[model samples]
Target: MSKELLKGNVAIAEAALRAGLQAYFGYPITPQTELLEHLSKRMIELDRVFLQAESEVAAINMVYGAACTGVRVMSSSSSPGVSLMQEGLSYIAGSELPCVIVDIMRGGPGLGNILPSQGDYFQVTRSAGHGDYRPIVLAPASVQEAIDFTVLAFDLADKYRHLVLVVADGLIGLMMEPCELPPFQPVRTTRPDWALTGADERERNVITSIYLKGEEMEGYNIKTQERLATIRATEQRWVEHLTDDCDLLIVGYGTAGRIAYTAIDEARSKGLRVGLLRPQTLYPFPEQRVAELAEQVERLLVVEMNAGQMLEDVKLAVAGRAPVDFFGRMGGMVPMPDEIVSAIDESFAKMAQPA
Candidate 1:
C-alpha cells in the first residue's frame, strides 16, 4: 500500500473513487467544501458524474435518482445543510436505496458555526430525518478512520440495502494525516433482481417503506427492529485503551474521542487509573461493550461536543451500575486535553465524597 498525506475530506473522496462510486451529488458546505471540490475535479478527469447541486435538498434527491438507476451515489453536508436534506434522506431510507451520506459535522441548532463539533450526534444517529428507521452511523475520530469508514459505509449500505452515514466532524474532514490508498475496484452497475428498475418483461417492483394498513406497518416495524438487532449483534465496534486496570472509564467519539485519549494518557501518568472507550459505530452503538466496561470501572465520564447527548447513551449502557458523568463543549468550541483531565479529576473527587 502506498502511503500519502491527505486531508480527511480529500481522503474520503479518494476512498469513494477507489470504492468505484459512479456519481457524487452534493452542495457546498463549510468544513466539507474540500470534499466536493476534490470530487468535482477528480470525477471529471475520471469520466464520472459529479454535480454541485443548487441546495442540499436538490443534492439528496439527485442521489435518490442516481441510486434508483443502480449506480453507487453519495452526498455530504454539514449540520445545517444536513438538516435541509432530511426530507430527502427520509425518502432514501423509505425507498430502501443503497447509498452513502457523509455528515462532516459542524456546530448547530440553526446556523451555528463552521468549526468541528459532535453536536450532530443525536441528529445523525437518532433523528435527522423523520421515521422510526435507523441509518447505519459510523463515527470516525481521526482522518484515517474517516477514509476507512467512508469505504466501509458503501459496503454496509449495499450489504443491508439501506442508507449508511459516515458521521464525522470538521476536524476529521479537514485535518491532514497519512493514509494508505485502497486498491482500485470495478464499479457494479447491476443491482439485485429485487431492485426497482423500470418495468419491462418482468413484473414491476415497488420499493417503498410505506404501509397503508396498521398490521402491515407493524410487520415492517418488526422486521426493521429485527434487522437492527442483527446489526447490534454483528456490527458493534470500539477501541479500548488502558482499560484492563482502570478505575475510571472515559467514553467519547469523533474528535472529542481523540481529546479524551490525551486526557486518559495524562491521567495515567499521574497514577490515576483512567481508561478510554471510543465507539466506532454509533448506531449499533457498542452499548453492550460500554456496559461491560461499566462493570469494570468505578466511574464513567462521557465527553462530547454536545451537551449530554452521548452521555445519555452511556447512562443507558451503564444502567446505574456506575456513576455516569458528563463533560461537553458546544457551539463549535472543542474541549482541550486539560479541560478533559480537569473534568475527570472533578468527577473522581465527586465520587470520592459522600452522597
Candidate 2:
C-alpha cells in the first residue's frame, strides 16, 4: 500500500473520516487547526455533518448531543480550549456516551503559549473532567501513530460506549510523515435502537447523565468502574527496549518516550546498563510493567516535558520497591537526547550513594 506524506493533524483527520465519523464539531486553535480545517472540507464533500461551533464548550456539547443518537461524533481542541470542554466531557462520560476527543496539547496554566508541551498530562490522564470516570487515553508519538490511534479510538469509543482521548503534542500535530491511511468505510446515518428518536420504537428512550437519587448514582458509578476495570486489564500497551538486561529503567510517554529510547540506546553504547519503557496508553497506564521492571532495575527515572506530571504515576507504580527519580523540562522547552543520557549517568551515581 502506498503511504501519503502528510502532516500529523491532517493525517489524523483523514483517518477519522475513514473510520466512519458521522459528525464532527470543533473550534480551532493553533497546531490542531489543520485537523479541523481538513475535516471541514472532507466532511462537507462526504455530505456528513460538520459544524464550526462558536466555542470549545459549545463544540463538546454538540458532540454530546450527536453521540446520544449513537453516531460517531468527535471534537478536537488544544489545552485551554480543552479546559472549556471539561464539563461537557464529564457530562458525556457520566451519560455513558461514546465520542472521540482529540487534544493537540499546548503550553498551559493560563493560555501560556501555542508552543508544544506535555503540560496537559495531569489534566488529561488524572482529571480529564470532574468526577471519577476514566476516559481511554492514547498517547501517540509519531504522525503515523497519530493516524493509527485516531482510527482505533473510534472503535474503542463504540465498543466501550465511553469517551476516548487521542492525545498529541504540538510537535506531532505539525510534523509531516508518510502514513498508510486506513481503508474508508461506508457510514450509517441511522440511529441505534436504544437512541432517542421520538417514540419510533414503541417506547420513549431517555438518555441522561443526571441521577437524582444517591443510590442510583452510586450504582451508575459502580457500573462505570466495572467497565473501566476491564479496559485497564486489556488495554495497557508499551514498548520495552534493552530492559531485560539493564539495571536502570527510564520510563516516558509520547515525545519524551521516543527521546528516552534513543538516549538509552546511546547509554548502552557507552557501557551504561540503562533501558527504556515507552507507554502508549496514558490511562490504564502500564503499572504492571513498571512494577515488573522495578524488580529488575536498581532505580527508575521518569522523564517528561512537564514539571514531572507523569512522575507521580511512575512513583505509584514503583511503590517504593526501587527508588524513583524525575527529570522534566517544563513550559515549552524540550529535553534533549544527550540530556537524558546524562540523567541516566547521574542516576547511577545517585544509586552509589549510601541511603
Q: In model 2, which runs have C-alpha deviations exceeding 4 angstroms?
A: none
Q: List the residue pairs that clash in candidate 1.
A: none
- Quantify all predictions' global Cα lDDT against the true fold: 0.88, 0.90
RMSD of each: 1.3, 1.2
Best of the candidates, lDDT: 2
Instruction: Please give, for residues 1-355, the per-residue lDDT of candidate 1 as tens digits.
Output: 8789999999999999999999999999999999999999999998999999999989999998888777789998989999999998888887778899999889888998999888888888885599888899999887788888988999998887788999888888889988787888887767777766778879987777678999988887787778778888899889988999989899999899999999988988888899999999998788998998888888989999988888888888899999988899999899999999999999889878998
Instruction: Please report the TM-score between candidate 1 and the true structure.
Output: 0.97
- How many times do residue backbones clash in model 2? 0
Candidate 2: tens digits of C-alpha lDDT, residues 17-122 = 9999989999999979999999999999999999999999899999999898888899999999999999999999998988999999987779898887899988
lDDT of 1 at 118: 89
